[model samples]
Target: METKNMEVIYQKVANILVEMIPEEWEKILLYAEVREGFSQIYFYYYPINQKQPVYSLDIVDVFNIDKTLHRKLKQELYECFEKLWNEFKVQSQEQLASLTYILDNMGRMKLNYGYEDISEISSEEKQDKWEAEYLV
Candidate 1:
C-alpha cells in the first residue's frame, strides 16, 4: 500500500484498537487475513506467557464493511502487522512480569521490589538484609 493509504489505515487501526481495548490493558496484537475480497482480522492480547493468546477479538464483521473496504483494510493490516506486533511484545513483557510477581507473592510478601531500575539496591545489600532478618 502507498504511504497516504497506509497512514489512513494506520489511523483506522488505531481507532479500532482504542475503541476495543480497555484502559488497563498493557498491549494488543493484531493479525489480519490478506485477500482480494473479504478477509478476516484477529486481535490477540498476551496477559501471560501461555500456549495461546489470553484474549482475542474477531474484526471480520466490523461495521458490516464491504469487500472493497475489507480488501483495503487487509492490505493495510498486512503492512502494519510487524511493527505493531513487535512493539506490543516489547512493552507488555515487563509489565506482565511485574504484575505476575506481585500477585504470586501477595499473601507471603516480605521484601519490596521495584519493577524499574534497582541498581542502587545492590545484591549484597539484599543478601545481608535477608540473612539478618531470616537467618537469626
Candidate 2:
C-alpha cells in the first residue's frame, strides 16, 4: 500500500479509538498477535486510580457504540494489522512468520511491534514481559 493510504488507515484507527475510549479512563492498550493459523487481539484499560488494567471487552457496551460502528472499527483494525504483519514479513526477509504489537493511547500513540515464540514460552512469562515493557 502507498504511504498516504496507510497514513489514512492509521488515522481512521485513531479516530475509532478516540470515539470508543471513555473519557474517565487514563489510557487503553491494545495487544495483537498474528501467526501461522492463529490471531487474537485484546484491549485493557487503565483508570485514573488503578494500578493494574481492568481488562475487558465490555468497552463496546460501555461506549454504547452502535453495532454498525463497532463492526466498522473491527474491520479497520484487522486490515491495518494485516498490513503491518505483511510489511514486517517483507522487511524481515521472511525470517519471521509471527508478529505482535502493543498499541497504547491515541494521542501518545505508542506502537511497539515485534516477534516472539509463544509456543515455547509460559503464559506467565509472556504476561510479565508485556507488563514490564508497556505498563511501566
Candidate 3:
C-alpha cells in the first residue's frame, strides 16, 4: 500500500477507537502511524491536560499480512476493544484509573500489553521507553 494510504489506515484505526469507546475517545487515541514499512502499528493515547500519552503499544510484525488476515484483524480488534471497554466501565473508581491495554498477539513486542492498573506504570524503567510502543 502507498504511504499516504497507510496514514489513512491509521486514521481509520484511530477513528475505530473513538467509535468503539466513545466516552474516553479523546483519551483513547493520540495517533496511529505505520512505521518501518508497516511492520509495526503504533497506537498512542494522551490523557486530558497531559502532554504525553499515559500508555502505548506497538502491534509488531503487521506487515506482509495476508489479505484475509488483514480483514480479520479489524474485526478481532473491535471485539477486543468492546471487551476492554466493558472492563473499563465496571471499575468502581470515581475517576477512571489511567488505563492502557496492550492487546498484542501474532508478534513479539516489549510492552506487556496485558490488562493492568494504569497507575502502576513502572518507575523501574524510564518513561521514554514506556512512551513508545502503543497497543493497536
Clashes of each: 0, 0, 7
Q: Tens digit of lDDT per residue, candidate 2, span 1-136?
A: 2355445655665676666555556676776666656555556777777777765467666666576776677767767666656655555543333333334444655555454566576556765676576666
Of the pair 2 and 3, which is ahead by TM-score? 2
Better model by lDDT, 1 or 3?
1
Q: How much lDDT does candidate 1 score?
A: 0.39
lDDT of 1 by residue, 31-90 (tens): 332222223344544343443433333334433435565556545654554443334345
TM-score winner, 1 or 2: 2
Residue-level error in angstroms, candidate 3, position 34: 20
Q: Please provide, for model 3 over 1-136, each residue's C-alpha lDDT reduced to its tens digit, 9 standing for 90 to 100.
A: 1234433433454445444331232344332111112212224544446565433333223224344554465565544334433343455323222233332222112212223333334443423454554432
> What TM-score does each of the candidates earn?
0.35, 0.63, 0.27
Task: Look at candidate 1 and give me any clashing residue pairs.
Answer: none
| Each model's lDDT | 0.39, 0.60, 0.36
Tell me the lDDT of model 1 at 31.
34
Query: Candidate 3 — number of clashing residue pairs?
Result: 7
Name the lDDT of candidate 3: 0.36
TM-score winner: 2
What ranges in model 1 sit over 4 Å off? 47-53, 58-136
Q: List clashing residue pairs in candidate 2.
A: none
